[model samples]
Target chain A: MPKPMLKRSVQQTQTNNVLSVTGNQKQNNQNQQMNKMKIDKLLRQKRSKEYMDALHKLDVGGHVHNQNKVDEITNAIKREFPEVEISGILLGYVSICYLGKPYEVHTLDIASGIIEHYKSGETLPNGMEKARGIALHGGYEFIEVYVDCCRAVSSNGTVSVISI
Target chain B: MSDRVISQANLSYIERNLSAIHGEIQALENDVDAVNNNVKVVYDQVGVLANEFHEFVYEQKKANRLGQAEIKLVQIRQELEKKYGHYDIVRRTTTGILQADDLGIVKKTTISNATEELMISTPNYWLAPCLVALSAWISDQPELAEKALREGIKRNDEKTSLFFAIICMRANRKSACLKWAQRYLANQDEENLDRKAIIVIDAYANGLMGADTEGVISREMTKWLEELAEKPGFVEQQTTQWTEAINLKREPIENSGYTYLPKYSNTWPVLEDILEGANLHANILAYLMDIFEQESSSAPIKAQLDKILTSLVTDFDDEELPLRKKEKFEQFVVEFCGDEDRARQSMAIEETAFETHKDFTQLLTDAAMKPESSHASVATQKFAIALSKEWILNAYNDVIAQNRMKIPTEIEINVDTFNSKTTDGQNEAQLVNEFTQLVTKEKEAALAKNVLTGFDKFLLIGGAIIAVLGVGMIFGNPLGGFIAVIAGIGMVIKHFNKKKQLVINEENIKKNYEQKLENGLQIIRAILAEVVDFRIEFAEKDDESAKVVDFLEQITPDQYVKNLSTSNRRIKM
Candidate 1:
């Protein structure tokens, strides 16, 4: 009876050892697969446009626009705001302000153009016109355009294009 | 029966023991497997960490390389900016010359060219910084100017001398200015020999020292003007044209059938001639203004000049001359009024105070009206002609005077004194003869003295070959004698080889030095381009971080390889 009991205990111990070893191996394999997934996720996050935009926003105050697009937008602005000083445009665009007034509409139009041009490859040749047309089409033509543009600053200090 | 009982018990005991040992062994094996797995995990982590570290290092190095390259690019750009900026100054100086020349002030040509060349050929290291300093100097930023000038000197830049001279002059450091001027004069090539640079230097030095340098400056100015005047068809042709125009008679002489002279025919040409003559006169007047303003001026002399000016203006309205002559007369009046002092004074007056200087204003108004005279029909006919003549004559005289003083008739050197004091053996007689010859020949002086010295050094090396031949002859062996004979012949060949080599080396040195300077200048230009681009890009960007990163990425490689390759081709002789 003693011998049989001893043998039974030994067998139970061996089985336990094998089970532990197999369990640990399985856990390790799972951990590796999870880590790989996490790395892939991080890489995808890094490469995303949203991530790049966030990085850019942190660095410079304004959104980036191609030189040609900027010229077109400025030209449109000039046509709309003929009475406005050209110096005002440069300062407003660069500092995003115009004589103590926020340049939200101008900033937003520039941002929308950047996104349209870079991400969707959509051409916004007449960004100012489209913006004005949209506002007019929406029955906001009676609004003072320059003043409205000035009042569209967001909480993040970025100017919004819809007001223009 | 007893043996069977004992064996069964032993078997049972052995079996139980074996099972326990087997269990222990399995546990140990599992432990080992766990340890192995942990090691694998550690190894994998370590490998990833190592790779990341390596990449970080590589990235750092890349960034550093980029930074270094950017720095180099900036340096080059700065150099080029200096060079081109100086070139711009040179261009402006050239433009000034052209303006002066077109106005018939050709005496300013040499000085203008020298100034231009000095600006263009300035070494990169000095050019940019010096230009910045110059701009600063112009803007009255003394500290910045000094910093720039010091930096230029530190770089051993050629522009250092020019900048040093300019700064010294500006700072009223007479001794320093003179030192630099003398050095410049000594180094000046033949083309630089009648250049205004020396005159400018002298004037600046003298002004700083409070020395009366007027006599010297006036003399040089006169000489240059005289030379210009001597040029055929300069003033005479214009005078003739004016004479012919004024000589034109309105009425024809009633002659017996065959008329020898046409009366009205001479009138038109005479009027045209007067108009032409007036223009030449205006040029001379303009030249005088430039000289008087630039050379030196005292308040008293400047004041006395006012009276002389008034007389010239009053004479313009003298109605005794013919219509054409009157027109020419009015031109001379306007030309006289165009003098720098008169213009400056006139311009200095407030518009509201036009009544205060009624006499001056009336004179100007009268001259202006003469140009619009109905009788002449041609606007500014008299004033234009006279102004041109005056400006041309003044310029010609000033140039002639300036040249006479600046050009040295003889360069004296004490051979014993120079040789004893300096390492260079001063061959005074030879130097003096050469100096005299150079003044006459002009062409030979254009080549640098270093080139000539290099040629002489090569000849000396050639002569030393005989020593080698003599050595071979000292040996008694027949083979040595044969070698000596061959060596003597070889010495002669070597002499020719060395002479050719010396010329080639000197040429190469000059060429290489110029190339290095050009490369350095090009690098500076590249930097300026980057700065311009950066400014444009930054202006366009809304995100500061993105702009910064973009700018960082825009760093260009700055690797300038100065070629110092010495060709090893032996002489065929």
Candidate 2:
């Protein structure tokens, strides 16, 4: 319950960092630690606009394209789960996990699918601690992902759904 | 053995060695005491620093949102103006026509020439033709007025009818006002009334429509209720919405009020929510009463008509809704920049209230409460509340029941390194005992780890025995036995000193733990007392719900019309 997961196994196949030998682990092993620091330094330099473009090819929040997609999926989710008065759909990437292993980044749809699974007797998504009746912040509910990046209300009909 | 000789200097030397070990123990005890004493102060400083960090983040977010939202506004306005320029002109011209009368600078012919120019310039614009009809009607040109009115109505009948209705009311023509209003209402689907229709309803409910004395509009309202009631789950949906709306009126309790409960109690989230929920009963009543108590607008008829017309002009046309929705969403920077969750939730509610048509209940409620936008007068608020009292009460009841079920039997208070619990503050003695037990278990575990082993104790005792044997042999073998005596004496002194240090270490552990337990007990007592106060306050607030009920009971729609009706103006006629 502490970690939100993806419904699709394909989504959880640990995204390989081809450039780094160390997989972001900070451990007691000196060799791994040194290699991790070296790899992280390189990655930090690779955060230029061109690198970001090459890595994030799908463009999770590409304004018009993603906005339209968010609108489409938001409507679908609302129709499918009318009881959940979603405020709006957000299209962005979130980090998720399978079992206990983390996949540093995944499309928001992976989390969306997990929520759909939550509706059908599967485990509730990890970040949604304030879902449904448990919600109390202003009589509105929220999902707060306290873990690093994976931090994953309608009014009396005043609010709506989020898709991405 | 009977008379082993020992020197006075040797005895004084032993006294000095034992005294040094006692002094060393005292130093370690003092160090532990100092650390224990500073724990609480250090913790308080950390808490303060955390609050300061929170303040920094909040301010930073606010500043960022401001900049981002400003940029969004500039972009949105540029688009809104470019695309909706034709619609914009109609709204601006409507206000100008009314303002021109007071200015008396523009002559009748000049006004005619301008309206004709606008019509030619903005072809196929609906309200432009409506403005021409209004100008013709005012100028007493019957043929031109009829022709323009037909054209305006043909373009948008609902808005044109509403336009003429407000104009007729301002001119004090009661029969024409009534007929035009009924015509506007006639075209509306009860469930899908135009967004602008709310303004008309607000005016009617406030008794500004002097002709509705015979209950013609009242019958239409009753018909709306009948139709809404016939729809399945309609009442339930209203209940949920009304509950949320009423809950929204509750002001949050100050965080510092129950300062330590949030820090100590795991149940604080639920506890906090229940307190607010309990307060809702009083808060919502006061909100409604405040509405009822505010003074009604007494603006002269013409001036009031001008405000209504201005609002109508500014209201978006059906064609502009898609773009307007985007504009409205971009209006808030935090939402526009990245806090899409808040933006989405807010827009959902806002869209419900102002963007689209809704049932009579929601329309009237918005008209009553969100008066700046919905334009419901004070009298209309009273009328709407009295009309929707049943739904309001049911929703309030549902909310109360839901909160009651979440009440926990026992609250768990988690202070640092201590887990204290209580069913209520009455369990103070039990809580103190439990904390002491936990402290005892911790102290015992630590002392156990540092205690001298069996071999060290055997060496300490065994060394003194050997020292005595060597002293007995001192007289027997003068130099050789004396060397054995010195070696045995050194071993005994070394272990005895070590044992003394271990005793001091044990005492320090005991003092440190006992002091920590005392601090935890103090925190528990302070937090427990607040828990008691919280319940008492919750009860006092919960009892105030009856006041809202009693207040609502006194409200009647018929009584409101007397304060707001234009019948006084009509009687003089």
Candidate 3:
């Protein structure tokens, strides 16, 4: 399930610039659409590193420490992509719930650095389905990050998202 | 009439409205049809696109450029990230490459290096990089691979732990393999790589220990390897299909590359791992021992391995197997490398055959008893004969395989010989004698009984006449007396006939018993002939010809052939 988001708030920054909060909610109370975040090079690099660290941590099987570690990672991700919802940390990877569906981003494509997700009703390539089952049953966690834009980010990395 | 006069205008208005409504309905129908046609066109286009894309994918695969295709997919993933902000993309290019790796393609250092770079470069994508590191180690670049593995471990990556254990296994770094394997077992999910880690630890520990005191540990390790080879690895997804298809036409792909041998202990473990569990065979143990001896040249390792395999190498005679089951148990152990269950099954079958043979021997002894003319005795003889024939036929292959007895080519039973035994155990002379005996006995008994019965009938008739005469005198009626006398004569004749038939039935019973006894003897003789023939055929090939005949000769008329407990009676008759 998608995490409950903070009510959309428009605040005047110290610089008098307007900032709005957007997250997993379907619509703002004012019925306004959430705008996609813009990805600049430096931001991508920073987010990419954080995502890598998160994945590294997940790989090392350390996700089950406590809510604090999860919150820390969740906050870091929320900072980068405010619209991405963190439902909970399951198995060591953050579960990014979308539209009431949770996708596990278990491994990265070394070439593209994109985290993999398996949605319900989607056919996995042959043995991967079984492997996914094993990984899930083995307490493997997944991290799936999707912004309104085509790009997705984890604390350690940024990747372009596509449906295969 | 006046009210109806204004209604014409109203009618005109209603008609106009109805016409307009009909036109609107027509328009709606047309619009619906157009929409349906447009949907159809879109579906057709999608189908074409999907087919074209599938074809393109197939072509790329055929050209073996799946690596490049994966790279392209990764680029698309990156493109999505650029447009959408950093996002998670599934079924990514890495999955396909990993499958290719399982097919022995991903082990190319260049490919693993590329994957490693992508993984290291990607933000927060740490889980898959450990796999890339594994590929590197597989490709013979251990240093960088170990570094990546360490990083994953630092990140608390469970996959990295498994990879490290596997890496340790490949290097023959036994202690490290044990450490990482135990850690992985403790922390790894039961569903994931748990079985794999267990298999590795079991094999390594057992293998490294060589042979424990009983050699049981090594055998267990071999069995574990056999079972492990049957399990499908993660990347085995596509290759499994490819291998199945390929196997239909040619040899199967050796493995899914999960347990490919690594650099350090590549020779023994790699060879051992890829044996498809052939290590579990007795010959394999012997072969290994032989090669080990040749390779080590009196090294301490030789002493250890020798101790380990000595029990395995011991002959069946030296082992604890029963003497009766030694032959079959030996063959089974030698073939299966002392697989206890199969050996036991084999021994069980041998035991059953031996028991059957013993039962047939006892039956023969019973059949040889004098006065074996009873119905039950005859049935026993028939049963024994049939069982002996079946036993010989069934045991032919087993005996030959075990080298217990050999039948020369000329010894095979011809159709005429088989028919001679199968038709009737009795010779023509026995049949004639049986028929003659039944005829003679029936004729003699029938003549004597007929004479006596006839005489008694006459005497009864005379006595009835006298009594009827007296009845006439007392009643003073001749008609009544005449009728009474006729009835008395008919009753007397019927009783005499029944007595004569009883005498004939007794004679028939006597004839049947004699015939049965004769037939039973013939059957026993035929079965004994077969046994004697088999012995003769076997004796011709025996170095100790006299021993074979001597065992057969000891089977006296009163004793069962099996009861002759001579050492030379190895060939069961």
Among these predicted structures, which one has the highest lDDT? 2
Best by TM-score: 2
10 residues in a row with least lDDT, candidate 2 chain B: B564-573
| Tens-digit lDDT track of model 3 for B452-497 | 4555656566657755674765467667666666666665666666
Q: Which tens-of-lDDT digit does each residue in B1-573 have in candidate 2? A: 423445666777888988998899899889888987798789889899999999888767866776777787788788878887777877887778766754556667766777877888777777888888777766778798889989998988877887788877766666677778877887888888765666566666555676466666767777788888766556656776777677667667686377888888898998888888787777677678788788676353335555656667778877778878777776744555545557778888987765566778777667555656656677677778877776775566456545543555457889877876665578888888888898999999999887667877776667777777778887987776677677777777777877898899899999999888989899999988988887677657756765765676676665665233443332111
The positional error of residue B272 in candidate 2, measured at the CA in angstroms, is: 1.8
The fraction of reference A/B contacts recovered in model 2 reads 0.00
Name the regions of candidate 1 deviating beyond 4 angstroms.
Answer: A1-164, B1-172, B190-267, B286-573
**What are the per-residue Cα lDDT tens digits for candidate 3 across A42-141?**
2223244554565454333322234444455555555655543323211122222232344433433222323344454453442233233223311212
Question: What is the CAPRI rating of model 3's predicted complex?
Answer: incorrect
RMSD of each: 50.2, 25.3, 38.6
DockQ values, each candidate: 0.00, 0.01, 0.01
Relative to the true structure, how large is the alpha-carbon lDDT of every model? 0.37, 0.63, 0.39
What TM-score describes the B chain of model 3? 0.27
Better of 1 and 3 by TM-score: 3
